[model samples]
Target chain A: MRTLLTGNYAVAEAVKLSRAKVIAAYPITPQTTIVEKLAEMVEKGELDAEFIRVESEHSALAAVYGAAIAGRRAFTATSSHGLLYMYEMVWWVANARVPLVMAMVTRTIGPPWNIHTDHTDLLTMRDSGWIISMAENVQEAFDLTIQGFRISEEVDLPFTVGLDAFQLSHTAEVVEVPDQQEVDEWLPERRQSYKVLPGNAVTIGNIGPNEYTAKLRYAMAKAIEDSRKVIEKADNSFGEKFGRKYGGLVEEYRLEGAEYVVVMAGAWCGDAKDAIDRLRDEGLPIGMMKIRYFRPFPKEEIKRLEGKEVLVVDRAFSMGYMGIFGMEVSSVIGDVTNVIAGIGGVDVGVEDFEAMFRKFASRKLQRLEWWPREVFS
Target chain B: MLTEVMILSFGGQGGVTAARILALAAVNEGMFAQAIPQFGAERRGSLVRSYLRLSDQPIRRHSSIKKADVLAIFAEKILKIVEVREFLRDGGITVLNAKHGIAEKSYCVDAAGIALSLNLVAAGWPIVNTAMAGAMAKPLEISIESVINAINSTFSGELARINARAAEIAYREVKKCQAGSST
Candidate 1:
């Protein structure tokens, strides 16, 4: 059925549909409403589940990890400072190989107390060994979340679905919500391989020898690396069931025969796509590639940019390194233009992108430029 | 084409609710709509804005409105903020909850006055979001039935009737203004 849902509520609805048995979370800005809605659903008997109220973000993730260990499909959510607070548990959940799912509302970290969109919060967890994916809109928030569960359980790795702070979190859009029965058929009950059953006790997360620790780390890495195919399988099945298909790892828009491609992720892709279309209309060869999954980086799809000049537009700058996204792309595709724009929720409209395209197409822009640089600022 | 509407008013006046109701109305009509609130350290009397976008297709850009096709102002005081007037796209329509006229393609209605008469108050101030939304719907070509239905769906019983009454008055008043206008 079609309904008007905020991105937060859409995630809550997805969790309900996914039949997550355990939801543990602490409330925080933007991300607060998602768990709040889930709590309300649990209270109202709409969704049968245990909603644990944790005192802090660290405990929130710990509670979900505990639930996962007990053989339950678990979930939690956090943003910005909350995520930073849960940093220890993030690595704990990944290292322990718990198949939990979390919705991360991306926000700028603050010394100035900003509550705006940025990728820094989620990007900081790049090496935590969790499957990370970002949604471009509210519908994708629902879709990716539903698929997140199967992907996470398949690999026994926790999954984090990232959405822009208020851009997607607070925004309400028309979403085609699928029926519960259909979703149930699409995603069967959680059959965890490892369980903390009372009679069958086994040592977990205990100190091990150097060789054992190394193998465990390698196993975690291999699971994430092998997850590329599992992610695709989940997306394909979801598409067949719900009639919506987001190209598994990356979605390419208007890239055919294009000379230049702008790389980005999350909700900003909408404006970037609009800018690309406008540039295309003006007879410029510009395209867009939106990265969905960041963990098992879609190196194959990105490597396809062999002859094309790629422009990486990042919303978060890694201080001395400039944009983290640009740095990562550079590691793969040798030379690329790094444009740091839209940090702290600065509006980068189609007009700004159009101007950038004009400059890139005309060879006026020579090197990496931070938008709203000292001059524009 | 996407129809972007930005609602400007003081906090506690239902600017965010107005955005939600507008999006709901659009969705009820089988169109795609997105509504977002401009979050900040806003107090009761502080200025606030909410954004809504409606389209036959999904809305892509989630940023705050830079150029809005329709600008609905719930407070006359906010008109002093230059950015409020600057956000309107060229040849765009403006819906104001004020007593006086403006020099553009605009419509005026005493939305707060109507809310006050209806005794709809939140935080001791007359709530004008639904009224402003009603006035906005008319100028933006949204259906009165959808606005009223949205109000009914968002609220219930006496409170719903009070807001619905305020919205109905503004909707009829704005229609009368449209009927009387030459431009």
Candidate 2:
């Protein structure tokens, strides 16, 4: 069904189609509207689920985590401080391998108390071992929320899908929502073949000493890496069945014969695509690399851009390290003159893209530090 | 050239609903229009920013609103909390929801008084926020009746009648900007 809805509303409806049995969320910007819509759906009987209302974002994730442990498909969402409040649970759920799905509308953490859109919140949880990805628009936000069901259940890990707060979450766009029959064919019921049994139950979490803890952590790392193959296979299989493909962990738009590329996530792609389209008209060899599956690192895909000058845009910062996206993309690209990007997400505008490109055109990345620069650095 | 404006208000003030009404008014006047809420955390005390990007051309960037031609501040106190200034383009209008007109050039209306006089209860009419929309329309070349139609679309049945009355009272309360007044 084609409808004009915000990314948040689209996600809420997608959860309905995915048949999530438990929904818990506390009101936070960008994320609140989604929960509100979900709450409404529960009230109206459009979406059959337990709309758990918790007083705090902490309890919200806790409810979903508990639900997932009970072997029910569960959901929760939050942004910024609300997400910060939900922070400790990320490590627990990932360790628990709960398989619940979370949608985090990213926002920059505030000292200035900003309500603008940015990726700092979501990126902060990148290493928390959740299967994380971002959405470029409402359609993907919907598609990914459903896709997460397959990825998480198969991998037996939780997933965090990032949409820019206010940027994608609130912006209304034309989205083609897949019908339930199509979605059902594309993504079937959860097949948790891991559970021992009710009659023969096994303890999932434990108070481990260093060795056991390290093994469990290494298993999570391996599981995240293993998900790379599982995700690619699932994406391909989903495309084959649905006849519409958004293949690869990273989606490339018009990059085949292009040189300069801008990496983006969430609704800001609307403007980045615009800037790319116009730059194309002017005959600039520029394109875009949009990372949808942010977790599993997608190193093989990043390796494909070896010699190309890719400009990575980060809506969130990494503080002591490089920009989160730039750092991750750097891990993939060995030694390429790629732009280390950090700019507009929620608080920034489309007009900001014009300036970022102008920087890319100049000798911006030419003098980038080579402290430990290797051939594949 | 159609003029566009944004009104930031509180939740109970009928902010989004009022903004929708004004956007519909602009559409009724044959202007290409868009009305969107500036997305953020949903809370009543926290800011509620709504955008009306009216122009001859269709708007494509449905992102954060950095600059607005006019800004309507519903709560007199929220002005201190949120970054309310520096967004307007030089001579843009700002309507305050205070009891008295601000020293700076602005439209001032006490909507609470008017809502009460009309004997409307239930939603306690965040009267000033509603009034600011009507005031904004006149300067931007939008007709008052069009805004009235917008309010009607958002609400109906028994509740709709009171809201229509609230909107009408709000229209009367708005004081227009002088032709050459420096904002």
Pick by lDDT: which candidate is best? Answer: 1
lDDT tens digits, residue span B66-111, model 2? 6677777777676667766666666677766654443345676666
Q: What is the lDDT of residue B106 in candidate 1?
A: 77
| Superposition error at B103 for model 2 (Å) | 22
Instruction: Give each prediction's root-mean-square deviation over alpha carbons.
Output: 2.4, 6.7
**Candidate 2 Cα outliers beyond 4 Å, as residue runs:** A53-59, A178-182, A194-201, A207-222, A233-244, A335-346, A364-377, B1-15, B18-35, B39-49, B52-62, B66-156, B160-183
Q: Give the per-residue lDDT digits (tens) of candidate 2, residues A1-377.
A: 54446678889988988988899999976578888998999999988799998999889999988778777789999998998887888888888778989998877677778777777778778778889888876667887888888899988899888887666787655556778888877777766655444586677675768999888888888899899888888778877865556776888888978887776666677667767777778888888887888787777877777777777766665667666777777777744344333333334345667656656766454424321223227
Q: Which candidate has the highest TM-score of all?
A: 1
Q: What share of the true interface contacts does candidate 1 keep?
A: 0.80
Candidate of highest DockQ: 1
The residue-by-residue lDDT of candidate 1 on A1-377, one tens digit each, is 99888899999999999999999999888799999999999999999899998899999999999889999999999999999999999999999999989999998899778888889999989999999999999999999999999999999999999999888998888889999999999989999767896787787799879999999999998999999999998989889989999888999899898999888898989877888888888888889888999988999989998789888888878887768888888889898888888888777777788888777777766567878556565
The DockQ-derived docking category for candidate 2 is acceptable
Q: Candidate 2 at residue A32, lDDT?
A: 81
Model 1 off-target regions past 4 Å? Answer: A198-200, A374-377, B81-83, B175-183
